[model samples]
Target: MTANRTALVVRGGWEGHRPVEATDRFLPFLRENGFQVRVAETTEVYADADALATTDLIVQCVSMGEIVPEELEGLRAAVEAGTGLAGWHGGIVDSFRASSDYLQLVGGVFAAHPAVPADEAPAPGEEYFREHVIEITEAGRRHPITADLDDFTLRTEQYWVLTDLLNDVLATTTHPAEPGRPWRRPHESPAVWTREWGAGRVFVATPGHDPDVLDHPSVRTIIERGMLWAARGSG
Candidate 1:
């Protein structure tokens, strides 16, 4: 019966992150789980207070875009009122770069990604994709979302994020030491985390930059479980 929950998935923004394709990967899983999913390509849906009020979950995939004051407020209020918020990569955490309130609500923000190799840099508009390893933390091994998921290698951007201490971190990745890199020490950045906002729950994963990343069995399983856990507010 919990699978009968309502879910609103908003997708769009900088296409380099493959928002559309990435979001598509999870559609079947959501439907199979009994979610009555509604797909929206714009952030304007957030301004529909009535719709948001009744929704059980919100899955956002927008990256590096602006959200209007009204729209942001609507989303904030919805989540605060107990509507679960779930997302990965920039869609949830990297969105609304100028809104500190949004950042606080999501509990993290994408700070940077390892710079691209000089020869691989895009011709201005393309995204620079890279690869790295993601490891589940000792705590993650015990969390429902990531429990039993093995450490895996991913050929996607290793996101360096600024996170809130309130987050319940489930997984992490260490930045490899490189000369001229901003971090002197190998920083263990959060790869997955969850937090509570008022009566609602928030689930975030730093992977999913590319659709193929989500296609990985381990990554997909974590995401699938995270959606259900966040919506139900329990493991």
Candidate 2:
């Protein structure tokens, strides 16, 4: 159904998030779905007008990095012109921390994660990643990207994001009251959301911090569906 469509994957910045590994996890799936994929390791490609002009979707895996003015403008233009943008975790939502325009387009920004214990840090074998349950909102069950998916639990960073009210929130996770975790206001946060920007569609899932997290069946399915939903030519 995705035949003849083009997908550009841009991965870089903050190796701690394992951007390359995370982005690679979905490459084969995109290809199998009939997308001609192009990958770039830097944001410089975003400045290339020709490249953005022909791209159908952009799956960005860049974490904290500064995008040059020209490049940022180009990216905004591409998506404004009907190209789809989709990503998970720091790659999409947490990227370009200083770019307000980018955050507005994506509709959310990572604020913080549960703080680690200062005194009793878990050793090598002990589980350090926090486990949280994500529940699908009533609206999520009616949305194409999340419909038919059940709520699930994941052990990963539960992102605290500042979101725009315009976003169509699909799923959410709550901040559990635990040691060193004093969440100020509402505990529930958007786990997945979709928004419209100009003629483009934007999809975001905040559950992926590790490649293994993306391997989860529900995570994989939602992201795949989001990508397809974002693609212009894909049915």
**TM-score: which candidate is best?**
2
Q: Relative to the unseen true structure, what is the C-alpha lDDT of residue 149 in candidate 1, on a scale of 0 to 100?
A: 88
Q: Clash number for model 2?
A: 0
Clashing pairs for model 1 are none
TM-score of each: 0.91, 0.92
lDDT for model 2, please: 0.89
The lDDT of each candidate is: 0.86, 0.89
lDDT of 2 at 145: 89
RMSD of each: 2.5, 2.2
- Which lDDT tens digits does candidate 2 get at residues 1-235? 5658899999999998898889888899899988999999999999999999999999999999889999999999999999999999999988998999999899999998865465657555333466788899999999988999999999777788999899999999988666555555558899999988888999999988887889999999999999989887655
Per-residue alpha-carbon lDDT of candidate 1 for residues 139-165, written as tens digits (9 for 90 to 100): 899988999888998877789999879
